[model samples]
Target: MITLKNVTLRRSAKVLLDNASVTLNPGEKVGLVGRNGAGKSSLFALLNGTLHEDGGDYYIPAQWRMGQVAQEMPETDQSATDFVVEGDTTLVAAQAEVRAAEATDDFERMAHAYMELHDAGAHDAPARAQALILGLGFKTTELTNPVNSFSGGWRMRLQLARALMCPSDLLLLDEPTNHLDLDALVWLEAWLKRYEGTLVVISHDREFLDAVTNVTLHIDAGKLVRYGGNYSKFEDMRAEQMELQQAAFGKQQDKIAHLQKFIDRFKAKASKAKQAQSRVKALERMEKIAPMLADADFSFEFKEPANLPNPMLSMSGASFGYPPPEDAPAGTPPTVIVQHVNRSVLAGQRIGILGANGQGKSTLVKTVARALAPIGGELTEGKGLNIGYFAQQELDVLRPLDTPLEHMIRLVRETAARGQNHGQGTREQDLRSFLGMFNFGGDMVKQAVGSMSGGEKARLVLCMIVWQRPNLLLLDEPTNHLDLATREALSMALNEFEGTVMLVSHDRALLRAVCDEFWLVTRGGVEPFDGDLDDYQRYLLDEAKRQRESLKESLKEPVAATTKIAESEAPKGATGTFSLKNAPAQRKLDAQRRQQHADKARPIKRELEGCERRMAELTQEKARIEAQLATPLAPAAIAETGKRLKAVGDELHALEERWLELTEEIEHTAGA
Candidate 1:
């Protein structure tokens, strides 16, 4: 158990936590969430003993061993496996004991030391380390590569592998998924779900938190709050708390009402109903969790484009990749990551790009963004196709020495030079005001882009994108540095934008909220992915299994196929059905069967949606009645309103129960 009693924590003169008391039990997987700079990292420091409490007591069980990813990048020339194996302090201590025992010529001590080494799994340390490394997205061939040969992101992955290699009763991970792609992120989630220790993590990813965390801890205004469930549950709880605070909740009420009006007026007139549904759904969610999200420091939107291109882009027999080295022989070929990509980008389409790392997700985006040319074949763009490209690396698009004001001014000048009238202000004062809309006010507009945080840089990129009013947006990992509030704001803004979007991101919450369809770039081609994110995750896991098995086959000597099945491949459940988790053929059943299940789920889903809409209506009516009751009213009117409130509550409860039942039925049908 870890306990903080009346703990006061401070960094310099700023108090992060004051008189905060909390208890963290063993074997709890907890997600710690807060706004950026609200002391989430400081709290991690407190737990790791890097910083002590300024007052009161903080205690952990003396026998508990803690494991955490190293913050500093490794500059060593050691092989990746060896470096990770060194992270196991227990094994290192045991080996050291054996050396000491041999030096002293003590037979008893030497035997004890050898036994300790064996118990620590010293003989299989390399294998264990390699598994961790590969699961974090390293190639098997690269296991023995010198650690210094990798880039900063890959090096940070090695550091995470090292942390996972260590045996401990408690593990702390901070933004572990920031460097990971979807493939590696899925693997890490599975690994953490099986972890036997108490796990605490800090992340802005809502889907990641929902998948891996059972408990949530929140830091708000120097107070530590603990919730009984995951991030979604915490949001629900917090929404309820805000609703109870009438003075605060009143401020955002009119804005929500205006949103409801917009939804009602525009849902029927929606040009693309499939795409516009995202907005209606998003607005419904916002109404439920209002005011809290309304508190974000940064909120802005993309201006509607001056013109819309029906077919924004078209590519035929295209090969997207980097050109050959200039020093290479004249006949040398270019590097083509994705070939034969025959696709068209349609106006109003919101597409999510899905693939493993190094599978050309970014390469395709770069090609479309005009950062690279097709190795072969043709790409055609529609007339008036204004492009706004946001690269994965902010530095790629930003001049380190330039200020925000300078960047905007240059954009204004470029637009003017091109003879365009996209409604951007031409004057210096106007550009400064535009920058202020993105939180770059006063001196911030003059601050060097190099001196800002990653989030600030991302905001600047978004600000630039909005200024151009592009009809087509090519964004790669755009939310990498944005906080939760900012992410929500972005999601809402995307829903409201009247333009085409092509996004590549590991943030599932953003993907699910924004994309109506998905494109999968895999192997050497691109195709439409005929599934949702949950289906894609299962596919990724199956793909990883196939990779692992292929690697195993390559390593072993030729032998009979009579080898025993691996434990993970064994039969599952009391029914003795063979493991379908890694069996692609078994899991890929006939379309007829899938359609039958979908048929069964359809009516239940319709019922559920009906109930949900009715519940929303009842909830809003209840709030309205409550607001009326809070004011001066005639006795008869008050009694009538109170009676209607009770009626609405009763119906809401009944419908809610039915909604739960329908949800369970549909899930069972799908699983069947």
Candidate 2:
């Protein structure tokens, strides 16, 4: 746990946090939210000791280790694994020294080194590392891949994974979900839900905070206000408070007006003069109500696309996978990533894809978009079908030097030159209008693409997509960087889009509220389901509960139900008779409740503890594995070790599943 006492931070002439006091406890998720340029990130740095404060004091426990995931990373020419492992460079150096001592056959030194290494569990670090990598959406194949090969978005994810894996009592995440696709986000949400340490994250993603955080901290007017509950709960409470404040202010204003009128009419009168002066003093002392800042009421209407034929895209005995290039021939077949896949996309359908990361979800999208031709199988585009693809890294498509207006104008000219537009001038006007709808007006429209945030770039990409109005839109993680308000706006536009949409998103609330059908991209293959996201989630829950029940039934033990019945149920000071005749019945009821609780409660508590234990174990294992693999080992030795490592990994995964099940059951029983 960590506490901030009388923490005041300021810039040249502006106050950021003024005498701010907050206490963060273990297992509590806190959201730090404010408007743009409101110093959310600055506050994070202050907490992490990366920024110096100008006034007051920032207090952190001396024994506590704090970790932070900043918005930016240092430019390093190293592999992603190398960058991540460097999070604890002192440990890495110690490992190297220990290894050297062993190699030199210095028995005494080796023995000492061995103790240190064993205590650190440097041998098991690799497994822990792999778990973190997989949980953060990295495939085994990409573990050794150079960090620079990935886009900035992916690089951000790698940085975040490092932060999550690092040992910390307090974790500060700044826009942690900015680069994650839906799958990674979901995994992160689940992980953070069971996270035992304290966390304060700055995010624009409401669903992320709502799913993970218990408290909302609003930074306004250089002060921090804490609200109990999630984002939605906070909003409701704030609204009620605002209404009361407004009413109070209205009453005060009326009194002030009446006093002014009395002063105007009777100021010279001796008795009236004294009374008017008292009213003036009271009015001056009264503080005005601060109006709540609300998002502008902005709605976007999509340009409806014309109807197209059925079977917009279809795959028969098809495979969705990427093949690695062989060493031998130029014309040889690519490696098969996803095989035996059969699916079809039809017009007037909005489909949501759900899957774990590294499950070929992106591959499927690519195949359908014709960005990559399928290695095997036939994929056909229906007649009259026009497709627009929104890749997860769509920002890469933007010319960094090009201004927003330039890109819009250039795109329009190209489209017009192809003879598809009403006119060049008209197209430009439409582009400008579309940009305006997205809150990019005048000077903002002229800002270079390189200067925009990920969310802004995504919004701009969407504007272009809507401008084109393609019959079929393939969107990959479109809402990754968008804030709650922008996300809602995009969702509304997509709902009214008059076109076939296939999207991959991890925000369950958004998916549940927006999607009409499901396309689950599993490790095995893509399976289509006939319901919305909420229904699919419900189905998953039901399946999990059924599995739990089946396991419980197999145990065949007579576990008494736990239900508490209180003795002396009458009022505390009641004059009526309080009978002791039903004591046996009450005792039996109490015993049954205790037994029932033990039956369910022990397992849940044990499982939760097991999860925490496993997480720590995995962390240690990963650190060890990374250190071992860092040395000059033979290829065969490495391969064999990797296989053993994979087994440990599989066990870790099973443990994670069990943890999720147990925690969910506990929540359900508590709710009940």
- lDDT by residue (1-672, candidate 2, tens digit) is 566677788776778888887776776789988765567877877877778777666667787777777567556677666667666534565577666864764555554554455455444455566567666777645665788888766788878877876777788887787667665666688888877778898877766888989989888777778898987667667656765776654644554453344334332322333223433332232212111212213446567666576988888989866666657577776767677887878887777787655677778887788788788888888986767788877655578788787888877776678666522245566768768877789889889888888778887888777676688888887877776556656655665567788888776555654455677776467787655544555665565467557445422221321231122332233556545556677567656655665666667676677787887787678667657756866655554444445456556756755664565565445323
List the RMSD of every prediction in angstroms: 21.3, 18.8
State TM-scores per candidate: 0.80, 0.63
lDDT of 1 by residue, 426-487 (tens): 78999899998988998999999999998899999999999999999999999889989899
The residue pairs found clashing in candidate 1 are none
lDDT values, one for every candidate: 0.82, 0.66
Provide the lowest-lDDT 10-residue window in model 2.
285-294
